[model samples]
Target: MRRPVTRRVLAALAATATGAAICVAVTTPQASAAVGSATGFATRNGGTTGGAGGQTVRATTGTQIHAALCNRASSSTPIIIQVEGTINHGNTTRVSGSSCNTAADVIELKQISNVTILGVGNGALFDQIGIHIREASNIIIQNVTVRNVKKSGSPISNGGDAIGMEANVRNVWVDHVTLEASGGESEGFDGLFDMKNNTQYVTLSYSILRNSGRGGLIGSSESDLSNDFVTFHHNLYENLDSRVPLLRGGTAHIYNNHYVNIRESGINSRAGGRAKVDNNYFRNSKDVLGTFYTNQAGYWQVSGNTFDNVTWSSRSSDNNPAGPNPTSNTSISIPYPYSLDAASCVPNIVSQTAGANKGIRTSNGSCATQNPTSGPTPGPTGNPTPTPSQPSGTNLSIGAGSDGSSKASGTSYGDVRDGNMSTAWSPSGATGQISIKWDTATRVSRINIREASGSVGNVRAWRVLNHDTGAVLATGSSAGVITFTATSLRKITFEITSSSGTPRVAEFETYAS
Candidate 1:
């Protein structure tokens, strides 16, 4: 039930001089990686290889595909554009020579780069039209099916994310697309694949995020801890309700995806965000992985997951209850390195290789069987909690701590002390402060603050001083792990002042208890 577009560009245009349907360029389709053909981002870092050997324009009207990307010549070559119909933008037009800014909506790949927007032949819908992608990079959006993109009051794309991805956007890869919206944001809709600020090495494969309640987000404040290396494999999050993708601290790697009928909450790794929940396949879904609705606490490393009639939501203070009997670790390190198919062969290998007209044919399930392991066999036993583990302490402030100020990145502020939850110490501003000193006067009581994955810098009513003597010791507003007892302390200060934004501190441990 998606079709209704046309706000101008009416005609069989080829008028004036000859035919109205001009914009035809064709070339690259030598089939590099195969899927729907134009070989666009299945994988190929940030510079992009989409539109492979370059040149292929087609278009039916999204304003002639923004006038063939405003007559592309450079953005580093590579271009494929195919599209076929349904592009109703309803206004804000401007893409005749290239900066392609349809701002109020529809088609706008602002700082363009190697592009690839395919949706060829028969059905290529973009109905209420969204597709923004600001400071662009190597992009690729395949198969197409964007619906209801209203909200013209200008939140730009957030108010209508069918595919937004903002600023300095890096290596993108959205495939077999199909984003819908019926409610959320008062029915105007938001997010289907929304990534903000410093969007990074991206990948949203075999896509199909149904109905919508935001199935996307990497980093967009909580002091926006720079978005990290992302990846959500073999996608299909149906009938959504929560951020099947709302991650802030970044390092996501959610595998084999297929979460059906999720009515409330699922995969919400908070602040010091870190996900690796692999081999997934949830069913009736409830609290499919918690920390949820904010308490700022996110970390997951679960393995080979598979839940059925799921329903969990008990343990509080960083809510926990993600189903099945799983637990995987090693934090997150997927820069690129594939092969891992087993969560009991996720719903028959995601119903035979996820999406985008599988012509490349998928599924190898049962990993070529051969298992007996003698005796006792059973499934779904007990122990349901366990995700937020890694947090002990020896970290007396790595390399001795001294950053009068920091938004971080040298490896993101020394990993708090390198105990590593993933690595973080971020200190962006709005009203900043961060301190930790020691020349020799140790034996501290406790001061664990592991919250750095974004929602808005946490830290609210801060205090926790000792900075040599003008003592304050402990105060609230949260980041976690508080316990004061200071004895021969040299210095310690964490003057946040106030926050619901911009707070990252992977682990600032000082425990002696």
Candidate 2:
């Protein structure tokens, strides 16, 4: 029924609450990289150069996409198939002379290599369809959304994930895309992205993953440790249960991501996975980064990470938090050169660049353009002034704040507006007060706070007070996106009168508009 890659992916997470389900079925570009390069394998591969020295064909239907792959001249011919509309698998056709029939399930690229699947126009979508890449190499997938691919019990038709890879898969770059399902197994969905069995040199950039029980995972077992040299950056992971993603044995470079409302956990590095966790904003999540709940202890070099209201577990038999409270790790070198966007800029950058339909957003470091291979991107729309998405005012409270009654190293009060959300100032208690005062009188209108994880999060009763005058400039229980009149002021403080529980305010941001 289902292929080797699909079955292997499903087998990895078919039991966990947020585990991946069987795919119904599905599935990159080519880089013109030399056999080996310093750019790292994943960054060096993708679509712009996929069809080079070959054909650049445009396909508007599922059958056309299948035809482009099936009719290719060997695995190295280099074909870039441009997809321009929603390709629904329900109406797919059979691939001639191959058991890889699409009418039943997925668009299989069993042995295809040197191909780039580029989505074009308003945006291309693979709806209720999946793409499988196995025994393939040198691929790129960009500017597309893969969603609602249902799972099937019929082994052949259960295409599996939004994207699945295994067995000698290599050198792929997936950028500016959205992959999701309504829920986990019960909803017939699987991993948004997955890799197994010697798969290596992959980069997932500027992508949006949301509303799923499981995000993604690397190896299938503690013994399957060959997966390595992967990079995940500037991706937005929101409303997930866990594994944004669960690393195992690979050497992964993770940075500048906005992880929001990870209902269960985030970045569960295990099985000796060496992760360089740097400059990420982890809000409303538990154990954001560390050797997580597993008997096999993974190592991490975590720095410049803003951990808001995140929880830490004890060093139990199978659950290790890996901290000063757990264990320390040495920093590893990332194969490619990358610029660290301040953790504070994570939300702004990820929200704007991630997911499909984003018009030609700037690439990350040396990474290439992720826009579709179609017409030029449309210009800005109606609004022109300062907006919430793009705050136009100065954060006067920068480097100015205290934990009021309690403070700790790396969690000091001054971390609030240091232009890094990865580091926060958590006070002593839920009912405590953390305030900001200016030596000189300053005017302000907007304030935003990113809460910590777990039940203690969700500030319910809070008040912003003028410290110098003891006058209330603005007061409310709301923590995120709080705005008031631009008033001539000297000081501001947030008092937690009541909350959903303890208020772990990770970021206390103020802006004048």
Query: lDDT by residue for model 2 over 274-328, one digit each (tens)?
Result: 8888888877667666666678888888777777656765567776765433334
RMSD after Cα superposition, model 1: 19.0
Compose the digit string of candidate 1's lDDT tens values, residues 290-320.
6676777778888778787788777766566
Off by over 4 Å in 1: 1-48, 51-68, 73-93, 97-104, 108-138, 141-159, 162-183, 194-202, 205-212, 216-240, 243-303, 306-513
- Candidate 1: residue 256 lDDT (0-100): 75
- Write down the lDDT of every candidate, Cα atoms only: 0.62, 0.64
Looking at model 2, residue 251 earns an lDDT score of 88
Query: Whole-model lDDT for model 2 versus the true structure?
Result: 0.64
Highest lDDT among the candidates is held by which one? 2
TM-scores, each model vs. reference: 0.34, 0.64
